[model samples]
Target: MNFQKPKVKAPSYELIHKTKNIIDKYSVNTICIESACPNISECFSRNSATFLILGDICTRKCKFCNVKHGKPNIVDSSEPKRVANAINELGLKYVVITSVDRDDLSDYGVSQYVKVTKEIKKINKNIKIELLTPDFHAKKELMDKIINSNPYKLSHNIETVESLYKNIMPGCSYKRSLKVLEYYAKTGILTKSSIMVGLGEKKEELIKTFYDLFNCGVKQISIGQYLSPSFKHHLVIKYYNKKEFDELKEIALDIGFDSVQSGILVRSSYYADKM
Candidate 1:
Protein backbone atom coordinates (compact mmCIF):
# COMPACT_ATOMS: atom_id res chain seq x y z
CA MET A 1 0.00 0.00 0.00
CA ASN A 2 3.05 2.29 0.07
CA PHE A 3 2.34 3.75 3.48
CA GLN A 4 5.01 5.97 5.05
CA LYS A 5 6.04 5.77 8.66
CA PRO A 6 4.46 8.40 10.87
CA LYS A 7 6.74 11.05 12.29
CA VAL A 8 6.97 11.81 16.02
CA LYS A 9 8.50 14.69 17.90
CA ALA A 10 12.17 14.43 18.78
CA PRO A 11 12.74 13.16 22.33
CA SER A 12 14.04 15.50 25.04
CA TYR A 13 17.49 14.16 25.78
CA GLU A 14 17.83 15.92 29.13
CA LEU A 15 14.54 14.72 30.60
CA ILE A 16 14.92 11.26 29.11
CA HIS A 17 18.35 10.95 30.63
CA LYS A 18 17.03 12.10 33.99
CA THR A 19 14.26 9.51 33.95
CA LYS A 20 16.68 6.78 32.93
CA ASN A 21 19.01 7.72 35.72
CA ILE A 22 16.33 7.23 38.36
CA ILE A 23 15.25 3.94 36.83
CA ASP A 24 18.86 2.77 36.71
CA LYS A 25 19.43 3.84 40.29
CA TYR A 26 16.61 1.58 41.45
CA SER A 27 17.55 -1.32 39.15
CA VAL A 28 14.08 -1.81 37.72
CA ASN A 29 12.76 -2.37 34.18
CA THR A 30 10.20 -0.50 32.13
CA ILE A 31 8.26 -1.52 29.05
CA CYS A 32 9.06 1.92 27.63
CA ILE A 33 12.69 0.85 27.15
CA GLU A 34 12.06 -2.84 26.66
CA SER A 35 9.31 -2.39 24.06
CA ALA A 36 10.98 0.63 22.46
CA CYS A 37 7.83 2.68 22.95
CA PRO A 38 7.83 5.79 20.77
CA ASN A 39 6.27 7.86 23.56
CA ILE A 40 9.04 7.12 26.06
CA SER A 41 10.47 10.61 25.79
CA GLU A 42 7.12 12.28 26.35
CA CYS A 43 6.19 10.02 29.26
CA PHE A 44 9.60 10.19 30.88
CA SER A 45 9.78 13.94 30.39
CA ARG A 46 6.53 14.15 32.31
CA ASN A 47 8.12 12.06 35.07
CA SER A 48 5.67 9.24 34.46
CA ALA A 49 6.37 5.68 33.41
CA THR A 50 4.81 2.27 33.02
CA PHE A 51 6.89 0.02 35.23
CA LEU A 52 7.83 -3.36 33.76
CA ILE A 53 7.96 -5.72 36.73
CA LEU A 54 8.54 -9.48 36.87
CA GLY A 55 11.77 -8.94 34.96
CA ASP A 56 12.45 -7.84 31.38
CA ILE A 57 12.65 -11.32 29.82
CA CYS A 58 9.43 -13.02 28.71
CA THR A 59 8.66 -16.69 28.43
CA ARG A 60 6.35 -16.38 25.44
CA LYS A 61 7.65 -15.40 21.99
CA CYS A 62 5.01 -13.04 20.69
CA LYS A 63 6.27 -12.03 17.22
CA PHE A 64 4.90 -8.48 17.45
CA CYS A 65 6.44 -7.70 20.85
CA ASN A 66 9.89 -6.13 21.27
CA VAL A 67 10.48 -7.45 24.84
CA LYS A 68 13.17 -10.09 25.06
CA HIS A 69 11.89 -13.65 24.91
CA GLY A 70 13.77 -16.59 26.46
CA LYS A 71 14.45 -18.20 29.77
CA PRO A 72 13.93 -15.42 32.32
CA ASN A 73 15.86 -14.84 35.52
CA ILE A 74 14.66 -16.04 38.90
CA VAL A 75 12.06 -13.77 40.47
CA ASP A 76 13.75 -11.21 42.71
CA SER A 77 11.99 -11.23 46.05
CA SER A 78 12.97 -7.64 46.81
CA GLU A 79 11.72 -6.21 43.46
CA PRO A 80 8.45 -4.90 44.90
CA LYS A 81 10.25 -2.62 47.36
CA ARG A 82 12.51 -1.22 44.64
CA VAL A 83 9.58 -0.57 42.31
CA ALA A 84 7.69 1.27 45.05
CA ASN A 85 10.76 3.32 45.82
CA ALA A 86 11.17 4.25 42.16
CA ILE A 87 7.57 5.41 41.87
CA ASN A 88 7.98 7.49 45.00
CA GLU A 89 11.18 9.01 43.67
CA LEU A 90 9.52 9.85 40.37
CA GLY A 91 6.83 11.70 42.35
CA LEU A 92 4.16 10.06 40.26
CA LYS A 93 0.61 9.94 41.55
CA TYR A 94 -0.51 7.47 38.92
CA VAL A 95 1.47 4.40 37.96
CA VAL A 96 1.05 1.62 35.46
CA ILE A 97 2.52 -1.82 36.16
CA THR A 98 2.98 -4.50 33.52
CA SER A 99 5.08 -7.63 33.20
CA VAL A 100 6.59 -10.10 30.79
CA ASP A 101 4.75 -13.39 30.68
CA ARG A 102 6.19 -15.61 33.41
CA ASP A 103 4.57 -18.84 32.31
CA ASP A 104 7.66 -20.60 33.62
CA LEU A 105 6.43 -19.79 37.14
CA SER A 106 3.65 -21.97 38.46
CA ASP A 107 1.56 -18.88 39.35
CA TYR A 108 2.37 -17.26 36.00
CA GLY A 109 3.78 -14.23 37.87
CA VAL A 110 0.52 -13.17 39.52
CA SER A 111 2.18 -12.99 42.93
CA GLN A 112 4.62 -10.35 41.67
CA TYR A 113 1.77 -8.28 40.30
CA VAL A 114 -0.12 -8.45 43.58
CA LYS A 115 2.97 -7.70 45.60
CA VAL A 116 3.95 -4.76 43.41
CA THR A 117 0.48 -3.24 43.52
CA LYS A 118 0.35 -3.66 47.29
CA GLU A 119 3.81 -2.22 47.72
CA ILE A 120 2.96 0.82 45.62
CA LYS A 121 -0.14 1.43 47.71
CA LYS A 122 1.79 0.98 50.89
CA ILE A 123 4.12 3.77 49.86
CA ASN A 124 1.21 6.13 49.25
CA LYS A 125 -2.39 5.06 49.46
CA ASN A 126 -3.49 8.03 47.39
CA ILE A 127 -1.49 6.97 44.34
CA LYS A 128 -3.68 5.36 41.73
CA ILE A 129 -2.32 2.10 40.37
CA GLU A 130 -3.11 0.51 37.00
CA LEU A 131 -2.03 -2.90 35.85
CA LEU A 132 -1.56 -4.31 32.33
CA THR A 133 -1.07 -8.01 32.72
CA PRO A 134 -0.58 -11.29 30.91
CA ASP A 135 -3.52 -13.66 30.48
CA PHE A 136 -2.43 -16.19 33.11
CA HIS A 137 -4.64 -18.52 31.12
CA ALA A 138 -7.62 -16.75 32.80
CA LYS A 139 -7.30 -18.78 35.98
CA LYS A 140 -9.75 -17.46 38.58
CA GLU A 141 -7.43 -18.15 41.50
CA LEU A 142 -4.65 -16.14 39.88
CA MET A 143 -7.02 -13.46 38.65
CA ASP A 144 -8.55 -13.12 42.13
CA LYS A 145 -5.22 -12.15 43.64
CA ILE A 146 -4.87 -9.18 41.28
CA ILE A 147 -8.48 -8.21 41.76
CA ASN A 148 -8.08 -8.28 45.53
CA SER A 149 -5.04 -6.03 45.25
CA ASN A 150 -7.45 -3.19 44.35
CA PRO A 151 -5.74 -1.50 41.46
CA TYR A 152 -7.62 1.56 40.23
CA LYS A 153 -7.78 0.08 36.74
CA LEU A 154 -6.93 -3.21 35.04
CA SER A 155 -5.77 -3.66 31.43
CA HIS A 156 -4.69 -6.49 29.16
CA ASN A 157 -3.89 -5.68 25.56
CA ILE A 158 -5.68 -7.82 23.01
CA GLU A 159 -2.84 -6.65 20.71
CA THR A 160 -4.50 -7.61 17.39
CA VAL A 161 -7.68 -8.88 15.79
CA GLU A 162 -8.65 -12.47 16.40
CA SER A 163 -7.91 -13.47 12.82
CA LEU A 164 -4.30 -12.30 13.17
CA TYR A 165 -3.71 -14.17 16.42
CA LYS A 166 -2.02 -17.21 14.89
CA ASN A 167 0.73 -15.20 13.21
CA ILE A 168 1.08 -12.12 15.40
CA MET A 169 0.54 -13.66 18.85
CA PRO A 170 1.73 -17.24 19.01
CA GLY A 171 0.78 -19.19 22.16
CA CYS A 172 -1.73 -16.43 23.01
CA SER A 173 -5.42 -17.01 22.63
CA TYR A 174 -7.73 -14.15 21.69
CA LYS A 175 -10.63 -15.68 23.62
CA ARG A 176 -8.52 -16.16 26.70
CA SER A 177 -7.46 -12.52 26.65
CA LEU A 178 -11.08 -11.48 26.40
CA LYS A 179 -11.94 -13.65 29.39
CA VAL A 180 -9.24 -11.94 31.43
CA LEU A 181 -10.68 -8.50 30.69
CA GLU A 182 -14.20 -9.72 31.33
CA TYR A 183 -13.19 -11.15 34.67
CA TYR A 184 -11.73 -7.84 35.77
CA ALA A 185 -14.64 -5.80 34.44
CA LYS A 186 -17.16 -7.96 36.22
CA THR A 187 -15.55 -6.97 39.51
CA GLY A 188 -16.57 -3.34 38.90
CA ILE A 189 -12.94 -2.41 38.38
CA LEU A 190 -12.28 -0.10 35.44
CA THR A 191 -11.09 -2.46 32.70
CA LYS A 192 -9.23 -1.63 29.47
CA SER A 193 -7.48 -3.23 26.47
CA SER A 194 -5.41 -2.16 23.46
CA ILE A 195 -5.24 -3.11 19.78
CA MET A 196 -2.57 -2.57 17.13
CA VAL A 197 -3.77 -1.64 13.66
CA GLY A 198 -1.85 -2.21 10.37
CA LEU A 199 -1.18 -5.84 11.14
CA GLY A 200 -3.05 -6.88 7.97
CA GLU A 201 -6.45 -6.85 9.70
CA LYS A 202 -9.55 -5.89 7.76
CA LYS A 203 -11.90 -3.09 8.80
CA GLU A 204 -14.78 -5.43 9.55
CA GLU A 205 -12.48 -7.66 11.55
CA LEU A 206 -11.40 -4.70 13.63
CA ILE A 207 -14.99 -3.67 14.18
CA LYS A 208 -15.90 -7.18 15.24
CA THR A 209 -13.00 -7.23 17.64
CA PHE A 210 -14.17 -3.95 19.14
CA TYR A 211 -17.67 -5.29 19.66
CA ASP A 212 -16.29 -8.43 21.18
CA LEU A 213 -14.30 -6.41 23.70
CA PHE A 214 -17.14 -4.06 24.52
CA ASN A 215 -19.44 -7.01 25.02
CA CYS A 216 -16.90 -8.49 27.36
CA GLY A 217 -17.12 -5.21 29.36
CA VAL A 218 -13.90 -3.48 28.37
CA LYS A 219 -14.61 0.15 29.20
CA GLN A 220 -11.48 1.74 27.75
CA ILE A 221 -9.62 0.96 24.49
CA SER A 222 -6.57 2.25 22.64
CA ILE A 223 -5.79 1.72 18.99
CA GLY A 224 -2.46 2.50 17.38
CA GLN A 225 -0.36 1.81 14.31
CA TYR A 226 1.79 -1.30 14.70
CA LEU A 227 5.40 -0.56 13.91
CA SER A 228 7.37 -3.72 13.32
CA PRO A 229 10.09 -4.06 15.99
CA SER A 230 12.55 -5.20 13.32
CA PHE A 231 12.66 -6.82 9.93
CA LYS A 232 12.62 -10.19 11.64
CA HIS A 233 9.34 -9.38 13.45
CA HIS A 234 5.85 -8.99 12.01
CA LEU A 235 5.65 -6.57 9.09
CA VAL A 236 3.39 -3.51 9.16
CA ILE A 237 0.91 -4.11 6.37
CA LYS A 238 -0.63 -0.61 6.42
CA TYR A 239 -0.65 2.61 8.42
CA TYR A 240 -4.01 4.15 9.26
CA ASN A 241 -4.14 7.89 8.82
CA LYS A 242 -5.66 10.40 11.22
CA LYS A 243 -9.05 10.14 9.59
CA GLU A 244 -9.09 6.36 9.90
CA PHE A 245 -8.07 6.46 13.56
CA ASP A 246 -10.73 9.06 14.23
CA GLU A 247 -13.32 6.86 12.61
CA LEU A 248 -12.23 3.88 14.66
CA LYS A 249 -12.48 5.93 17.84
CA GLU A 250 -15.94 7.13 16.88
CA ILE A 251 -17.08 3.60 16.18
CA ALA A 252 -15.73 2.27 19.45
CA LEU A 253 -17.39 5.03 21.40
CA ASP A 254 -20.64 4.45 19.58
CA ILE A 255 -20.40 0.81 20.62
CA GLY A 256 -20.13 2.02 24.25
CA PHE A 257 -16.43 2.39 25.12
CA ASP A 258 -16.27 4.94 27.95
CA SER A 259 -12.93 6.16 26.62
CA VAL A 260 -10.92 5.70 23.42
CA GLN A 261 -7.43 6.73 22.36
CA SER A 262 -6.57 6.17 18.70
CA GLY A 263 -3.57 7.47 16.81
CA ILE A 264 -0.22 6.43 15.41
CA LEU A 265 1.53 6.69 18.78
CA VAL A 266 -1.32 5.83 21.13
CA ARG A 267 -0.53 2.79 23.29
CA SER A 268 -2.15 0.89 26.14
CA SER A 269 -0.44 3.01 28.81
CA TYR A 270 0.13 6.24 26.88
CA TYR A 271 -1.36 9.13 28.81
CA ALA A 272 -3.10 6.49 30.88
CA ASP A 273 -3.67 8.74 33.90
CA LYS A 274 -5.55 11.26 31.79
CA MET A 275 -7.85 8.56 30.54
Candidate 2:
Protein backbone atom coordinates (compact mmCIF):
# COMPACT_ATOMS: atom_id res chain seq x y z
CA MET A 1 0.00 0.00 0.00
CA ASN A 2 3.02 2.24 0.16
CA PHE A 3 3.98 2.33 -3.52
CA GLN A 4 6.03 5.33 -4.63
CA LYS A 5 4.46 7.90 -6.86
CA PRO A 6 5.72 8.10 -10.44
CA LYS A 7 8.34 10.73 -11.27
CA VAL A 8 6.14 12.92 -13.43
CA LYS A 9 6.50 16.68 -13.41
CA ALA A 10 4.38 18.76 -11.04
CA PRO A 11 0.99 19.93 -12.29
CA SER A 12 0.47 23.56 -13.23
CA TYR A 13 -1.79 25.03 -10.56
CA GLU A 14 -2.85 27.90 -12.86
CA LEU A 15 -4.05 25.52 -15.55
CA ILE A 16 -5.67 23.25 -12.99
CA HIS A 17 -7.55 26.22 -11.54
CA LYS A 18 -8.73 27.31 -14.98
CA THR A 19 -9.93 23.80 -15.77
CA LYS A 20 -11.76 23.58 -12.44
CA ASN A 21 -13.42 26.96 -13.13
CA ILE A 22 -14.64 25.82 -16.53
CA ILE A 23 -16.02 22.59 -15.07
CA ASP A 24 -17.72 24.52 -12.24
CA LYS A 25 -19.04 27.30 -14.50
CA TYR A 26 -20.74 24.75 -16.71
CA SER A 27 -21.86 22.79 -13.64
CA VAL A 28 -20.35 19.63 -15.07
CA ASN A 29 -18.30 16.75 -13.63
CA THR A 30 -15.16 15.53 -15.36
CA ILE A 31 -13.36 12.22 -14.87
CA CYS A 32 -10.12 14.19 -15.01
CA ILE A 33 -10.88 15.85 -11.68
CA GLU A 34 -13.05 13.15 -10.17
CA SER A 35 -10.54 10.32 -10.65
CA ALA A 36 -7.58 12.54 -9.78
CA CYS A 37 -6.07 11.52 -13.09
CA PRO A 38 -2.28 11.84 -13.33
CA ASN A 39 -2.64 13.47 -16.76
CA ILE A 40 -4.93 16.21 -15.46
CA SER A 41 -2.37 18.99 -15.94
CA GLU A 42 -1.65 18.02 -19.53
CA CYS A 43 -5.25 17.37 -20.51
CA PHE A 44 -6.56 20.49 -18.74
CA SER A 45 -3.79 22.62 -20.22
CA ARG A 46 -5.06 21.56 -23.62
CA ASN A 47 -8.68 22.30 -22.62
CA SER A 48 -9.77 18.69 -22.90
CA ALA A 49 -11.76 16.69 -20.36
CA THR A 50 -13.83 13.53 -20.26
CA PHE A 51 -17.25 14.57 -18.99
CA LEU A 52 -18.70 12.26 -16.33
CA ILE A 53 -22.47 12.30 -16.71
CA LEU A 54 -25.38 10.58 -14.96
CA GLY A 55 -24.12 11.74 -11.56
CA ASP A 56 -20.92 10.75 -9.77
CA ILE A 57 -22.42 8.00 -7.65
CA CYS A 58 -22.01 4.49 -9.02
CA THR A 59 -24.15 1.43 -8.31
CA ARG A 60 -21.31 -1.10 -8.20
CA LYS A 61 -18.39 -0.99 -5.79
CA CYS A 62 -15.40 -1.87 -7.91
CA LYS A 63 -12.34 -2.33 -5.72
CA PHE A 64 -9.98 -0.36 -8.00
CA CYS A 65 -12.21 2.52 -9.03
CA ASN A 66 -12.17 6.00 -7.57
CA VAL A 67 -15.86 6.66 -8.31
CA LYS A 68 -18.14 6.69 -5.29
CA HIS A 69 -20.37 3.67 -4.84
CA GLY A 70 -23.80 4.10 -3.25
CA LYS A 71 -27.28 5.34 -4.00
CA PRO A 72 -27.12 8.04 -6.68
CA ASN A 73 -29.07 11.27 -6.97
CA ILE A 74 -32.11 11.72 -9.17
CA VAL A 75 -31.33 11.90 -12.88
CA ASP A 76 -30.55 15.41 -14.16
CA SER A 77 -32.54 16.19 -17.30
CA SER A 78 -30.40 19.24 -18.20
CA GLU A 79 -27.04 17.43 -18.18
CA PRO A 80 -26.88 16.81 -21.93
CA LYS A 81 -27.20 20.49 -22.85
CA ARG A 82 -24.63 21.45 -20.23
CA VAL A 83 -22.17 18.93 -21.66
CA ALA A 84 -22.71 20.17 -25.20
CA ASN A 85 -22.37 23.79 -24.13
CA ALA A 86 -19.21 23.08 -22.19
CA ILE A 87 -17.68 21.28 -25.15
CA ASN A 88 -18.61 24.20 -27.39
CA GLU A 89 -17.18 26.76 -25.00
CA LEU A 90 -13.94 24.84 -24.76
CA GLY A 91 -13.74 24.75 -28.58
CA LEU A 92 -12.96 21.05 -28.49
CA LYS A 93 -13.27 19.41 -31.87
CA TYR A 94 -13.11 16.02 -30.19
CA VAL A 95 -14.72 15.25 -26.83
CA VAL A 96 -15.13 12.26 -24.53
CA ILE A 97 -18.33 11.66 -22.56
CA THR A 98 -18.51 9.00 -19.82
CA SER A 99 -20.63 8.21 -16.79
CA VAL A 100 -20.88 6.24 -13.57
CA ASP A 101 -22.76 2.95 -13.56
CA ARG A 102 -26.41 3.90 -13.09
CA ASP A 103 -27.73 0.41 -12.58
CA ASP A 104 -30.68 1.97 -10.75
CA LEU A 105 -32.05 3.18 -14.07
CA SER A 106 -33.88 0.69 -16.23
CA ASP A 107 -31.68 1.48 -19.23
CA TYR A 108 -28.56 1.61 -17.06
CA GLY A 109 -28.10 5.26 -18.09
CA VAL A 110 -28.16 4.53 -21.83
CA SER A 111 -30.80 7.19 -22.45
CA GLN A 112 -28.55 9.84 -20.98
CA TYR A 113 -25.73 8.83 -23.31
CA VAL A 114 -28.02 8.90 -26.31
CA LYS A 115 -29.28 12.34 -25.40
CA VAL A 116 -25.81 13.73 -24.82
CA THR A 117 -24.44 12.31 -28.06
CA LYS A 118 -27.41 13.67 -30.00
CA GLU A 119 -27.09 17.09 -28.39
CA ILE A 120 -23.41 17.28 -29.14
CA LYS A 121 -23.98 16.29 -32.76
CA LYS A 122 -26.84 18.74 -33.10
CA ILE A 123 -24.82 21.62 -31.72
CA ASN A 124 -21.65 20.87 -33.65
CA LYS A 125 -22.04 18.56 -36.57
CA ASN A 126 -18.32 18.40 -37.21
CA ILE A 127 -17.26 17.62 -33.66
CA LYS A 128 -16.27 14.01 -33.04
CA ILE A 129 -17.49 12.19 -29.92
CA GLU A 130 -15.99 9.22 -28.09
CA LEU A 131 -18.19 7.72 -25.41
CA LEU A 132 -16.67 5.67 -22.57
CA THR A 133 -19.72 3.86 -21.25
CA PRO A 134 -20.70 1.27 -18.69
CA ASP A 135 -21.72 -2.27 -19.73
CA PHE A 136 -25.46 -1.66 -19.34
CA HIS A 137 -25.36 -5.19 -17.95
CA ALA A 138 -25.02 -6.29 -21.59
CA LYS A 139 -28.67 -5.54 -22.29
CA LYS A 140 -29.42 -5.60 -26.02
CA GLU A 141 -31.82 -2.65 -25.89
CA LEU A 142 -29.39 -0.41 -24.02
CA MET A 143 -26.52 -1.32 -26.32
CA ASP A 144 -28.77 -0.58 -29.27
CA LYS A 145 -29.47 2.87 -27.89
CA ILE A 146 -25.75 3.66 -27.74
CA ILE A 147 -25.10 2.35 -31.27
CA ASN A 148 -28.03 4.33 -32.60
CA SER A 149 -26.54 7.55 -31.20
CA ASN A 150 -23.65 7.10 -33.68
CA PRO A 151 -20.71 8.34 -31.66
CA TYR A 152 -17.39 8.32 -33.55
CA LYS A 153 -16.23 5.66 -31.11
CA LEU A 154 -17.89 3.71 -28.26
CA SER A 155 -15.62 2.39 -25.48
CA HIS A 156 -16.10 0.38 -22.30
CA ASN A 157 -13.17 -0.46 -20.10
CA ILE A 158 -12.65 -4.12 -19.23
CA GLU A 159 -10.67 -2.76 -16.20
CA THR A 160 -8.74 -5.95 -15.50
CA VAL A 161 -8.09 -9.51 -16.58
CA GLU A 162 -10.84 -12.12 -16.49
CA SER A 163 -9.41 -14.22 -13.66
CA LEU A 164 -9.45 -11.26 -11.29
CA TYR A 165 -12.89 -9.90 -12.13
CA LYS A 166 -14.79 -11.53 -9.30
CA ASN A 167 -12.49 -10.16 -6.63
CA ILE A 168 -11.36 -6.90 -8.27
CA MET A 169 -14.59 -5.82 -9.96
CA PRO A 170 -17.13 -7.81 -7.93
CA GLY A 171 -20.50 -7.30 -9.61
CA CYS A 172 -18.99 -7.07 -13.09
CA SER A 173 -18.72 -10.04 -15.44
CA TYR A 174 -15.68 -10.39 -17.69
CA LYS A 175 -17.50 -12.39 -20.33
CA ARG A 176 -20.33 -9.88 -20.39
CA SER A 177 -17.85 -7.07 -20.96
CA LEU A 178 -16.50 -8.92 -23.98
CA LYS A 179 -20.03 -9.38 -25.26
CA VAL A 180 -20.57 -5.66 -24.99
CA LEU A 181 -17.54 -5.02 -27.19
CA GLU A 182 -18.65 -7.72 -29.62
CA TYR A 183 -22.12 -6.22 -29.82
CA TYR A 184 -20.77 -2.77 -30.52
CA ALA A 185 -18.37 -4.16 -33.12
CA LYS A 186 -21.18 -5.88 -35.01
CA THR A 187 -22.79 -2.46 -35.53
CA GLY A 188 -19.86 -1.38 -37.77
CA ILE A 189 -19.19 1.66 -35.56
CA LEU A 190 -15.68 1.88 -34.10
CA THR A 191 -15.60 -0.19 -30.93
CA LYS A 192 -13.01 0.18 -28.14
CA SER A 193 -12.12 -1.16 -24.67
CA SER A 194 -9.42 -0.59 -22.05
CA ILE A 195 -7.64 -2.64 -19.37
CA MET A 196 -5.26 -2.01 -16.49
CA VAL A 197 -2.08 -3.96 -15.74
CA GLY A 198 -0.11 -4.53 -12.47
CA LEU A 199 -3.03 -6.25 -10.84
CA GLY A 200 -1.13 -9.49 -10.11
CA GLU A 201 -1.85 -10.78 -13.60
CA LYS A 202 0.74 -12.78 -15.48
CA LYS A 203 2.02 -11.88 -18.95
CA GLU A 204 0.34 -14.89 -20.48
CA GLU A 205 -2.94 -13.95 -18.88
CA LEU A 206 -2.64 -10.46 -20.27
CA ILE A 207 -1.91 -11.86 -23.71
CA LYS A 208 -4.94 -14.08 -23.53
CA THR A 209 -7.08 -11.09 -22.59
CA PHE A 210 -5.76 -9.24 -25.62
CA TYR A 211 -6.69 -12.16 -27.86
CA ASP A 212 -10.12 -12.31 -26.26
CA LEU A 213 -10.78 -8.66 -27.05
CA PHE A 214 -9.38 -8.86 -30.59
CA ASN A 215 -11.46 -11.94 -31.36
CA CYS A 216 -14.50 -10.09 -30.04
CA GLY A 217 -13.97 -7.44 -32.77
CA VAL A 218 -12.60 -4.67 -30.60
CA LYS A 219 -10.78 -2.23 -32.86
CA GLN A 220 -9.00 -0.04 -30.31
CA ILE A 221 -7.58 -0.81 -26.86
CA SER A 222 -5.85 0.99 -24.00
CA ILE A 223 -3.55 -0.62 -21.45
CA GLY A 224 -2.26 1.23 -18.40
CA GLN A 225 -0.67 0.73 -15.00
CA TYR A 226 -3.22 0.47 -12.18
CA LEU A 227 -2.43 2.87 -9.36
CA SER A 228 -4.59 2.35 -6.30
CA PRO A 229 -6.71 5.46 -5.74
CA SER A 230 -6.54 5.21 -1.95
CA PHE A 231 -5.41 2.93 0.83
CA LYS A 232 -8.84 1.43 1.07
CA HIS A 233 -8.80 0.47 -2.63
CA HIS A 234 -7.00 -2.48 -4.24
CA LEU A 235 -3.26 -2.40 -3.76
CA VAL A 236 -0.91 -2.26 -6.74
CA ILE A 237 0.55 -5.72 -7.11
CA LYS A 238 3.34 -4.43 -9.33
CA TYR A 239 4.28 -1.48 -11.55
CA TYR A 240 5.04 -2.24 -15.18
CA ASN A 241 7.84 -0.04 -16.44
CA LYS A 242 7.69 2.01 -19.66
CA LYS A 243 9.38 -0.73 -21.67
CA GLU A 244 6.84 -3.28 -20.48
CA PHE A 245 4.02 -1.00 -21.59
CA ASP A 246 5.69 -0.61 -24.98
CA GLU A 247 5.95 -4.39 -25.32
CA LEU A 248 2.30 -4.81 -24.43
CA LYS A 249 1.30 -2.24 -27.02
CA GLU A 250 3.22 -4.12 -29.67
CA ILE A 251 1.64 -7.38 -28.60
CA ALA A 252 -1.83 -5.85 -28.74
CA LEU A 253 -1.21 -4.41 -32.20
CA ASP A 254 -0.04 -7.82 -33.40
CA ILE A 255 -3.24 -9.29 -32.02
CA GLY A 256 -5.03 -7.10 -34.63
CA PHE A 257 -6.12 -4.07 -32.62
CA ASP A 258 -6.19 -1.12 -35.03
CA SER A 259 -4.84 1.26 -32.38
CA VAL A 260 -3.32 0.77 -28.95
CA GLN A 261 -2.45 3.27 -26.23
CA SER A 262 -0.38 1.74 -23.45
CA GLY A 263 1.52 3.56 -20.73
CA ILE A 264 1.77 4.17 -17.02
CA LEU A 265 -0.74 7.03 -16.97
CA VAL A 266 -2.94 5.97 -19.87
CA ARG A 267 -6.48 5.85 -18.60
CA SER A 268 -9.34 4.69 -20.80
CA SER A 269 -10.17 8.27 -21.84
CA TYR A 270 -6.63 9.57 -21.97
CA TYR A 271 -5.80 11.12 -25.34
CA ALA A 272 -8.89 9.31 -26.59
CA ASP A 273 -9.31 11.57 -29.61
CA LYS A 274 -5.85 10.78 -30.89
CA MET A 275 -6.99 7.39 -32.10
Instruction: Find the 10 residues in a row with the least total lDDT in model 2.
Output: 1-10
Separate clash counts for every candidate: 0, 0
142 Cα displacement, candidate 2 (Å)? 1.3
Model 1's alpha-carbon lDDT is 0.93
lDDT of 2 by residue, 1-275 (tens): 43455665666788768777878988999988778788888888878899999999889999988888899999999999998988888889999999999989988889999999998988999999998988899989889888988889888888889999989988899999999999999988898899999989999999999999999889999999998889999988999887888999999988889999999899898888887
- Residue 79, model 1, lDDT: 98
Q: After superposition, how far is residue 160 of candidate 1 from its true place, in Å?
A: 0.7
TM-score of 1: 0.97
Best by lDDT: 1
Deviation (Å) of 171 in candidate 2: 0.9
lDDT (C-alpha) at residue 47 in model 1: 93
- Per-residue lDDT for 1-275 in model 1, tens only? 65666776777889889889999999999999999998888889899899999899999988889999999999999999999999998899999999999989999999999999888888999999999999999999999999999999999999999988987788899999999999999999999999999989999999999999999999999999998889989888898988999999999999999999999899999999999
